[model samples]
Target: MNDLRSWRVPLPQTAVKCAATVVLAALAVLSTGDPQLVFLAGIAALGAGALALRDLLAPVRLTADAEGLTVVSGYAGKRRVPWPDVTAVRVDERQRLLMRTRLLEIETRDDLHLLSTFDLGEDVRDVEAELLRLSARD
Candidate 1:
């Protein structure tokens, strides 16, 4: 088996955003005595804190080797698909709002796995090429 190669979702930016949200929520609660504003701030803080903790605890990771592919998604935990189980690997593009995003779709005999570009940390095409190369060796 070859060495396992791993890719992780980029979270520094998200960490910063979460921190900013918490700070802003704190400031809002401190600056105003209004109960309504304070309640809203508290809710914001809770949501932001939850997101931060989730990102810290369960980061998305993708690992591949001679054997197969492993995906560790936040909240979803981990899933492993062996090479023989993978029926196809392709790049999928979707438009959300005004932005277009690319993702890697791995189709197994009984299931499908979608990996975001953020999680793959590389061009979907490159990941697809690697998948093809690894699958060919089987």
Candidate 2:
């Protein structure tokens, strides 16, 4: 295998959001003093903490080698697709009113894998170009 290239999903902002959620939940429990409110806040704090821990522990990683690509998604586990199995690589764009987003889709013989811009940490066009170059070598 050629030198393995890896990209880490950006999560500093997400970590901040998670921490804020937990803090707010704690404050709600302390100020409200309502059993129901406390319970709800506890649940929210747990959920947010779990998400934060998941991101910290099993952070999303995208790796490419001479053979193919590997995606390690937190909680969702990992997936590996060889270049021979990849039939097409394209960018899928979605627009919702004024908001627009792009995703990289890798079409294999039997499945389609979607990669978010956040996970790629680079432009989809550049990733596509690299994938094409690596695939062409084989």
Candidate 3:
């Protein structure tokens, strides 16, 4: 449990998907001369390109260290949480449609942050264990 100290998690899959969306939309815009279709495709391409840039750029989705954690706020900015402010970090497991899903839950006084494997790029149990170890030292 004490082998780790910090972590930076990024959503690579999402970035790849966004990049693909941008490419496909750009192609659609180029292929169609219809004003309405071109306009829609151009908008879609721009939005996906923005999202792709965000995902590919340096500010990763989640970062953790001995002092605290920081998460990118969808496109707004980064949100930092000190260790003292963290109330709990656990795996929230649920069953739906005959499938089991697990998410990492980080709770604070005012907010509950839930992260999936797609978000963390790591198993929730592993993340929970590392987080517990970090918090235990504090």
Candidate 4:
């Protein structure tokens, strides 16, 4: 049974693009004739813009199989967590499942390893029940 789906964060790209544009514009105005400072600020702004763009484009996927759990997101890239290594899994404040493969959320907060939320909204209770049942078995 392959459950494939996707969820999106709100206005990820728009906000990023707007902020980047504003920063670049500001840098341009303040730059005057200082090439070095302008260059550095421009680079920083571009980097932030790139990160935001990445988040906007990245896909978060959750897949289960005979092997185990897999989370695919642009930030964390692709990761597979064997069932044994999974300590706990729960939906986070952002609605993404938080998977603990090791030392809790200390490592990453990106939902790269997220399971798909495609049809979860319509069957939340059933899904929770299923998760509880599976967790108990483990």
Backbone clash count for every predicted candidate, in the order shown: 0, 0, 0, 2
Span of 10 residues, lowest total lDDT, candidate 1: 51-60
Predicted candidate 3 versus true structure: per-residue lDDT over 101-126, tens digit per residue: 99888898778888777666778899
Candidate No. with top lDDT? 1
Q: Residue by residue across 14-99, what tens digits does model 1's lDDT show?
A: 67758867796886769677888778777778777776665566565678888998876446478888988888899998899999
**Shift in Å, residue 105, candidate 4:** 2.4
Error of 3 at 1 (Å): 13
Summarize candidate 2's per-residue lDDT along 1-138 as a digit string, tens digits: 576777655777567758867796876669675877777777778777776665666565567788888866436577898888878888898899999888888888887777776766788778877777777754
TM-score of every model versus the real structure: 0.74, 0.74, 0.71, 0.43
In model 3, which runs have C-alpha deviations exceeding 4 angstroms?
1-15, 33-47, 74-76
* Runs of candidate 1 exceeding 4 Å displacement: 73-76
Better of 1 and 4 by TM-score: 1
Candidate 4 clashing pairs, residues 3+ apart or interchain? 62-115, 71-113
Where does model 2 exceed 4 Å of error? 31-47
lDDT of 3: 0.72
Ranking by lDDT: 1, 2, 3, 4
Alpha carbon deviation, residue 56, candidate 1 (Å): 1.9
